[model samples]
Target: MDFIQQKDLSCFNTLGLKSWAKNYISLCNETDLKGVLGLLKSGAPYFILGGGSNVVLSEQIDQIVVHNQLKGINLVQESASEWLVEAAAGEIWHDFVVYCIQQGWYGLENLALIPGTVGAAPVQNIGAYGVELKDRLDSVLAYDPLTQTERVFNNGQCCFAYRDSLFKHEEGKGLIITAVRFRLPKQWTPVLSYPDLQQYESLQPGLTAQAILEAVCDIRRRKLPDPKVTGNAGSFFKNPVIPAQQYWPLKQQFPDLVAYEQPNDCYKLAAGWMIDQCGWKGRQLGNAGVHARQALVIINTGKACAADITAIAKAIANDVMNKFGVLLEPEPVFVGAGY
Candidate 1:
């Protein structure tokens, strides 16, 4: 219920961009969540921030920033085939993944080590190692500020597809996610479809869920930079999925193009490889630079502003388009004005 004026959010976001909000509120529970109804009804502009992992904030935000701090974990149901678990929107996503593994519940191992909160998960439809949140999600509890009513969205209603869901579209806008319910399979299988995880099947005598979790965490740690040490928002762009008609011609042009076969005769071209080919990896434009180890990442070499990060990203996207004719889309949500 307590609101602070002109709050600095440099540390709140992983990118470490210097952003200031006219007002800020940290909602720790449902009681605190309802306390801001007056502000909502008063027609004040606002933004909901959770974990601040997948967002880009401008230097100055002309809105009230609500920080979701709600936290709890509960066992909702248990069946012969599945286990229904619910987690508060504000819980750290990585910790929740580890907790599920510890409880002997499986199915979310492939999604381990992803940054952000449970609320932000569905918004981005987070995925890794061939598994996505939609694969395990059952339902989501969200409060629609537009109507000031709560609704439960079933898996089908969520309309999940490649790093996206209903939460990103018009119908789900301004809706505050309260909690997420996951229907994890009791009978589990390790998802090692990705080339990196394929090696683990031979390395471990009997591949276990814990091993997969650890391996995923290790792979991410080795590949991506920790925002604590170097400011970053992880992968900067989504791999472009092109049709066969377009893929074959590009393949003929670039024999070394890194790509994988997708469903419906489509191909998912590796965005990192394309960026590297453009000679931007480990290169800096102003204070923003592409990570030397991972070309998909845009790092704030320290003291970089939103504009600096935006500059390098635009340069990289532009270069990729000119060379490959593929449009690269940024994965993270760019917030505020002048993005």
Candidate 2:
């Protein structure tokens, strides 16, 4: 483990926001974790960070940043029709998905190009192109900081909601994920359920895992801004889910409302459409602005502070709520001072 004081966290986060942490340590294994935890016990507040894709550091973090760098991959189990692959907490998510597809494994191809780590996947229940991580997750290994014990949680235990999981909830706080296991199909048909995905399929009749991955990548490339070039999280807010009865009345007021009804009698409304309708797309406020192509994403044009970005996001949410009567929830975890 390499420990440093007054560490610059600009390179660690995808947003490229300049922030400082009181102390930072990168843990490569379980043994390294023990030593790091010792520092935490010695009266240091700490935060566990993975790929740093889904977070926005609002201010200088006075706490210790424990960068989860544990890495490894192994086949835990296999059968004629399926296999279970286990990955450490720090493994890059998109790269792992591509690896599985290369091995002829199915299920994760639709989720290709998502930025983050294996441990963070379960926290957000990351999804794309009509497929969610919960569908492939076997279990997750996490260490409870309070209990000081390792626990394994199965699919049902995850309590997955749209773009959320137990880890994002109150009961699962202070648990640092160590690894995750996924059950993947040996033979399967690709899912082209989303409207864009279906249209892409029409262009190419038969598709495999690699083809689906390429399509997803292409779609994302055209829609979302690349974090490397533009400082932005994939989507700033989640698609709001509301009761079916509430959705229809809102739809009546706005006939162009985009929504999908879930099996549980709820409607998931398109956040991007709402933001775009409110005339926020491509709109700029100093260094902070909504991505020209994707209204759901808020970007930092070099000099924007975390507060500026948060202010812009809040304004978008307020405008959407005023127009559509639907409240928008931020997708990224806000650390330090919040909006």
Candidate 3:
């Protein structure tokens, strides 16, 4: 592995935060794990970066940064009821969704246009519109660098939750996802449970998977700013899930609360709505600003650093908490303590 010294990574992260790495390497091949393991064994600290759509980078990282650029996609099998599709870790998530749709496989349309790589999806159990990755996942192929061996974990093994999976835990943290296999249903139905999709389908009357995919893309494009044009990490915070006991009183207090009742008697409160209610929509602190249309997004207006992003995020979170008593948690991973 050829490690570049002092690599500039402003363009590497979706937030466009100015950052520098003491050592950096782009892993384009799975076989390069041998070299990566050697470097790790040499007592050097390291960080694994995927599509860079879900992270906040610090100004300086005094460690090795391994960028995942691995890529491939294959149809493993075609059953009477479903299709088994597999994609490499570094494959663009939106591209893979389009490929599955092109093959006539359905079930992932609701998650269309989500940024990041296939590998990073399972880490956060990426979801949008009305569906989640766990709903279509067959299994995940991961490499254990310490053991120098690979293992395949089924959907259940993933321990998927709202915007989370086993991959975020300690045991699965070091496991490098190589590829992801999805079981997309052939006899598909539209997931129109989300209010946006529900209204869309009501307007369209008869909807197909392709149409749903297009609608999802349109909805996302309108809500999320392109990382290239205006740097942003999509949704900045996760929707807070509160117990039913607590939700009722809050609901009574704020009748216009936007929330979805969970299957487990909890309520997933919309973080964006709460932030907007707190008078934070389109607000700015330093170089960071809340996206005017989508209060969930914190954007880099111009060369914003992680500090600028954090400052705005902290202010919004604090305001939301003070008003609603719900603590907001950031969805993106912070790469350094400085942020």
Candidate 4:
């Protein structure tokens, strides 16, 4: 465990935003968690951080920042067709995916290049190219702060809904994720379901997990700005899922309202398309603006405060709601006072 005071948090977050944590502690293993929790119990507010990819710290944090750095990976079981792999919370998400691919495991290739940690993956149910983390997750090991006990939750117990999971819900609040377990397939069955991925397949049909991973990484690199360079999260808002009836009227009006029908009577609409049509794709407001290539992402050109970014996000959401009658919800967790 490493502890520091008045830490400069610029390097901790992927966005490279200039921020400070009053106190910061990095836990290298679960054994260090008790002392960290004791610090948190001292009555100061605390924030649990993983890879710092999916978060925006608007202001200097006055509370303790517990940087989850637990790391390890083990193959618990392997059969003729399947393997169960377990990863500690602090493992880098993309690295873990690459490791699985190197070991001949499939299912996580489509999610390659996503920034964050294994623990945070389950919280957001991270997905890409028609592949979601829930599809491969076996269970999650989390520590209940209130109970002071470690509990394991299965897939069904996670209550995954689109990009949401139990960790995002009220009941699962105050629980810190310690580790994640995944079931990977030995036999390759590539998922080329998304439009872009399918198009890639048309060019080269028999895509392996490695091929899919490379393609997804290339696509993401071209589409989303690297947070290290641009100081931005991958996507600012989630694609709005509206009722089918509501979607039909908008589709009739625009004729190109990109939508996908869900299992229920709902329709998922592309947030980027809406923002782009509203003429906000490359629009800049001060240091904050929509990414020129991807409208769903908001970037900090330089020295943009969290409030400035949040203001732009609100403006985009308002315009989309006014024009399409759909509300855009933020994908990243907003921390600090101003959010």
Candidate 5:
């Protein structure tokens, strides 16, 4: 294993926060993971890093950092109704979505342009445009460092909820995801229920998966900054899901409050809308600022550190909470103390 020491990770994470890993190991093959996992099991602290899209490092990391680099995408099976596609943990998520379209596979079009790796997808139950990862996930293959064994968790076993999964739970803390397999349906259906995609209905006459993918990409491009150009980890806060009864009274007060009804009579309120109402949108605090286009995003304007970003996010959350009774929770995982 080519383990490096004292590696700077400022560029690795999407937020571009200044951070350093005390010891770093890049695992390009499955075999490379055994040694790293063994070390972690034997009382060595470690953090498994994927595409570094959904994390914010507020301080230098003292543990060993294992960067998952395993790469592969293969068609596992095909039938009249479904296509089983498996991708390595390190495969770029958008690239994989594009590949599926090229292969004539559908069902992932609505999830296009989501940042992060296949491994990270299940961890966060990534969702966008009225679709979530758990909607098409077949199973997740992960390695349990404590047990020194590989475990395959089917969709139900993953315990997927809104922006959450078993991987984020206590029992899954020591597990390292190796790969993800998605079951795409052969019967294609357009998911234009979202208002943005609904506007593209005129193109629905002969719209293909590529067309939907392109439309979604265009929407994301307009709404979000390219992480390469502006440092950010996509949506900074998860949409707060409040009970329908509670949301009704709040809705009566704030007629412009954006929310969507869920299966269990709960309403997923727009965190961005509330933040914008709190006057955080397009506003800056030091080097970090809320995105002008989307209040859900907190951007690193220039020379923004992890502290700058977290402090601004907290202020926004606090403001929203005070204005409304709902507490806004951050979406990105914090990798350091007091963030």
Candidate 6:
């Protein structure tokens, strides 16, 4: 296994924050994965990085960073009702979604254009267009360094709940995800539950799975800034899911509050709407700023440092919390010191 020492990772992460790792390794296959784990210095801090899309590198890291680059896609199972496709952990998520659509597998179309890798998808329980990764995930193959054993977790075992999974828990830590299997239903139908998608259906008429995929890609492109053009990790905050008791009174006070009803009478308030209402949209704090068009995103404007980005985010969160009395949780994992 080849390892680079004191490697700079400014460009590796979508946020484009400057940081360095004490040691780094990029694995291309299962063999490489197992081999490197055994070589890692015991008791030393280590981090498993996917596409680096959902992480914030706040300072220089002393840990060993393992970059997952394993790649493959196979049709593992088939039945009259569904098809099971397994993709390697390192496969680009958006590309995999497109591949599934081309192969007539339809469920992942709603998750198109989501940045990051297949492995990171289940960890974050990634969601968009009214569809979540948990909806189609069959199982995940992960290697736990604790026992030095490989394990499989079914969808239920994953314990998915709104951008969260077992992979984010203490027990699941040190487990390197190897591959993810998705169960795409053959008797598929377009998920048009989201208002924007519903609007597309009314205007376009007769939307196919591919059409939905395209529409989602287009919608995301218009809504999100391209990371290549502007450094960002997509939505900076999770939509706050508040209890109905509080939501009802808050709704009366802020009539234009954008919120959606969840199961069990909870309400998911739009984080972007609240930030925008706090007068943060298109505003900049030093080199970091809230995206002008989408208040949910924080952007690195040219010379922004990790501190600059975090300061902007803290200000936004503070303002929103002060105004609405709802604490806004950030989406990206903050790495390094003083985070």
Best by lDDT: 1
> Candidate 3 at residue 18, lDDT?
96
> Considering lDDT, where higher is better, how would the candidates rank from best to worst?
1, 6, 5, 3, 2, 4
- Comparing 4 and 6 on lDDT, the stronger one: 6
* Residue 314 displacement in candidate 5 (angstroms): 0.8
Clashes of each: 0, 0, 0, 0, 0, 0
Q: What lDDT is reached at residue 176 by model 3? A: 73
Model 2: per-residue Cα lDDT at residue 52: 86
Please say which candidate is ahead in TM-score: 1 or 3. Answer: 1
Q: Give lDDT tens digits, candidate 6, residues 1-339.
A: 568998889889998887888888888876787777687636567899999999988567877888899999999999999999999999999999999989888899989999999999999999999899999999999987666778999999999999899998888867889999999999887788888888874336666789898889889998999999999999999999999999999999999999999899899999999999999999999989989999999998887777887788889999998999999998888877444
lDDT by residue for model 1 over 15-69, one digit each (tens)?
9998998889988877887887656766677788999998889888887898988
Looking at model 3, the pairs that clash are none
Q: Worst 10-residue stretch by lDDT in candidate 5?
A: 198-207
Candidate 4 or 3, higher lDDT: 3
lDDT tens digits by residue: candidate 3, 1-339: 667999999989988899998889887885676677666765566778898898998899886898877899999998888889999999999998998888888888888889899999999999987788898999999877667678999999999998898988888977778899999887788788888877764338667888998988888888789988999999989999999999999999999999988888999999999999999989888999998899999999997888888888888989998999999999998887544
What are the runs in model 5 whose C-alpha is more than 4 Å off? none
Model 4 over residues 272-308: C-alpha lDDT tens digits? 9999999999889877888899999899888876777
Off by over 4 Å in 2: 201-205
C-alpha TM-scores of all predictions: 0.97, 0.96, 0.96, 0.96, 0.97, 0.97
Cα lDDT of all candidates, in order?
Answer: 0.90, 0.87, 0.87, 0.86, 0.89, 0.89
Worst 10 residues of 2 by lDDT: 36-45
Return the TM-score for candidate 5, rounded to 2 decimals.
Answer: 0.97
Q: Which residue pairs collide, candidate 6?
A: none
lDDT of 5 by residue, 114-228 (tens): 9889899999999888799999999999998878889999999999998898888788856789999999988888777788988865456778889989999999999999999
RMSD of 6: 1.4
What's the TM for model 3?
0.96
TM-score-superior candidate, 1 or 6: 1
